[model samples]
Target: MMRRYFQCLADRDAPAALRLCTELVEAGRSPVDVLLDVVAPAQHEVGRRWAAGEWTVAHEHAATAISESVAIALGARIPQPDPARGHVVLACAEREWHGLPARLVGFALQEAGWRTTFLGASTPPTQFARFLDDADADAVAISCSVAAALPAARRMIDASRETGLPVLVGGGAFGRDDTRAKALGATAWAPDARAAVRALESIAPPPAGPSVNRRAGIDEHAELVLRFAEFRDSARRRWAAVIGEDAATPLADDALDHALHSLSAALLTDDSRLLREADEWLSELYSARGGPSCAVPALWSALRAVVGEPLPEASRHLGLLRQVGRSAPRLI
Candidate 1:
């Protein structure tokens, strides 16, 4: 049944997919089960396929829109119980535009009999804090889809903590085998919506420590950040020189920005594994966007030459890009 629903989504048949879910509910399947078991898996697969270059961004976006609609429909079908447990605020980190994970968690919270305020995507910290000021929330659940948004997440987490709100952090940004949330001062971490719901049920707020700037704490990372800023300016000027004058297009700009963002995020953890993984994913994403693989090699080499010996990860990443360039489509 889930596979059938996924097919409906891939076919862009929102109505049919909704109908299938409606029938599942009519047949005594719990709405929450359908959400967790059906909608969630389908959305995950959609993301995976997109990353694997099996589907275009348009197809992924269409499927996600339909899934968001389905989540709303399911929320309507499921009765919201009184706030017997507690009131919770759900939001994605600032600039983290993917909200489906937060949405699903909101629905799950509602099912668990908690009053939830879902702030949706790209919720600014000040704006979210303002909202929290007026509302009575026991906990805040922050969803971040990208590692690049962790700085924003840290800001939100700090703001929430100022109000004595216990924060539960979860998302793909943390990657596997990492404690990014706790490292950022979160009360607890939840890897998924189900775990988020459970975490909210029973989580003790940790003792607050003096707020620290995560980026400025590490000497090497701080230096790298400064070097990257200078390198970015040089790369822009030299882009036309290396890739041709026509190579300074938006696609090229986006690829460079992506590389910088990923590398910066990886700097936070100083994890070599994460740096390599991020570059691998970025290479795949760049290719998926029809970005020339040559751009990856070009950008990495430029950064290496400009930044000097400070960032060794750039060398490792450049190796990956060179391998990618070997088999990728030629520049147009």
Candidate 2:
């Protein structure tokens, strides 16, 4: 099964991966085996290839699309228990397109027996709140792939709380920093879906990790996003100073690109060519500097998530999506 998955990756065949996965399941492979062994491994390999420049951004995106479809198929086969694994609605802020990690979390929870309701990438806050009420989910989880998306993630969690749903934070936005998670009033920081189940063991417990990602206010999300970015930049600068660009070259060329791309995929579109270009950026930084990439495909997904792309009149409401965070009153 694992070999079949690798074959798909080497061939850059998303559809082939899905077909092979289905066949393996019929052959009695456990869904868990498919995910832990086949699905996750193939995705990781694709990432490895992209970082090494063996694969282009386009190739990576195709691979992710195929892998996600297989995950969905495998998830469907999991015997969903009654009451629906405590309904979980997964999404990212309107400006955030990193949905792969969130999907992984969603799938993990779904397979763990949660009735997962995935809103996919670039979900508008207005709709996100509505989904919570409509789905009457037990909890709402937001994934942020970059610091820029932190403001949006904070708002989604805040709005999700109006209905009194427990808001959970995951993804790169919270990766190098958990304090932002606390400051945003996130009930918990799950890191990933598997961790989410543990994080949500009950209602938001007394934030056990750092205690800054949560707070009380309206625009607080935006303030946190700014602070998050400032902090990330500062941390990065300090690290650069200490390591000196020359010494960090290898890591910049390899690992950092992979990490940043991972950050982008969770923060940007899964199929984003822009995220893969993070490697190009890394190449420049390392020339001598380095960077990183997933998610489901959405029509106008990247445009909706990032700035610069002008939307058609029909998508004007898409701007409302960012309003959720922009409207959030900042904390002192």
Candidate 3:
């Protein structure tokens, strides 16, 4: 039953996650086990597919929200031991309002016998700093799904370090540059939130010895940098025009997430002209701006990543803008 449930999530089938959770509850399947195995692994699976472009961001989110809701249903059933190895504070950077991963980390950490404070995304840096000072957490784990929020992640890391707080940063951006993780002042970076639990355990007793490693030969992404720049800016302009500023600044996760997946049919079209058009359209997008739009920098960053090495800061800024998608509902 759990195996079938896992398959549904891998397929990004929302109804399956929810229905399976209900059945598992009825069948005496430990909610804790369901979340530990069924939800996290499934979430990771969907995330992997989304990265490979096999699934749209919307489908990934649908899978996430459904799984999160199920995890929430499990509730206090998540393990919580008084004798924890250490405590961690998890939050998203300001301007980055996605929090589903942090929420998942909160549950996953509990299962690992570590205490965690699930701080949702877009939290002000000042308040985040205060929380660390007050809570005296063993380490602070910051997350961001959108690449645009990375600078904010850097700021949070800087602020935490000023107070001697051990910090680890993770998310989509980290997926782009594991080395930039430390460059941003993070004590370390994890491929995923669950991996963070292992990172924390492996670090040591004090949990504050900061180690920075440069993953040599990790400096460039030619195609992403050169090819993606113009196209990314264009996409941002289209997104901004479609959603407008108010909706664009604080993107509607549900709407944008929905749009990404709904467009999968486009990905299925094999016409070379259509694909060429897609590529060319990105190049011409908002050409009047003279560069990539300010909205989706991460796409720019990820693109530059393909360019590899000697990546200038200007390129990162451009890529970050492309990370913003058409998440808002069109204002007709």
Q: Which prediction has the highest lDDT against the true structure?
A: 1
CA-lDDT, candidates in order: 0.75, 0.57, 0.56
TM-score of each: 0.82, 0.61, 0.55
Task: Flag the better candidate by lDDT, 1 or 3.
Answer: 1
The stretch of ten residues in a row with the least summed lDDT in candidate 2 is 292-301
Indicate which candidate wins on TM-score. Answer: 1
Q: Put down candidate 2 lDDT per residue, 1-332, tens digits, no spaces.
A: 57778788678777787788888888998775677667776777777677566777798887787777778878778877676657878887776765666777777776677887788888888877777777867888888765446556655876776777778887755654455565666877865556777876676533334323222222232332344444334434444543455324545334333433333332322122323333234434333213311111111223233321222321233333333432112100
Lowest-sum lDDT 10-residue window in model 3: 262-271
Candidate 3 lDDT over 1-332, as tens digits, reads 55676687767676767778778766887665566566776666776666455677787777777777777777566667689877788899886766776776667677788888888769888888878778868878898765445546766887777777677777754544455575565777787646877777765332343332232212222223343445344544555553356224423232233222112111111111222222223333323223334333233223334323443432333333333334112111
**RMSD, candidate 2, Å:** 13.3
For candidate 1, lDDT tens digit of each residue in 31-86? 88899899999999999898777888899999999999998998898676763588
Q: Which clashing pairs does model 1 show? A: none
Model 2, residue 327: what's the lDDT? 18
lDDT of 3: 0.56
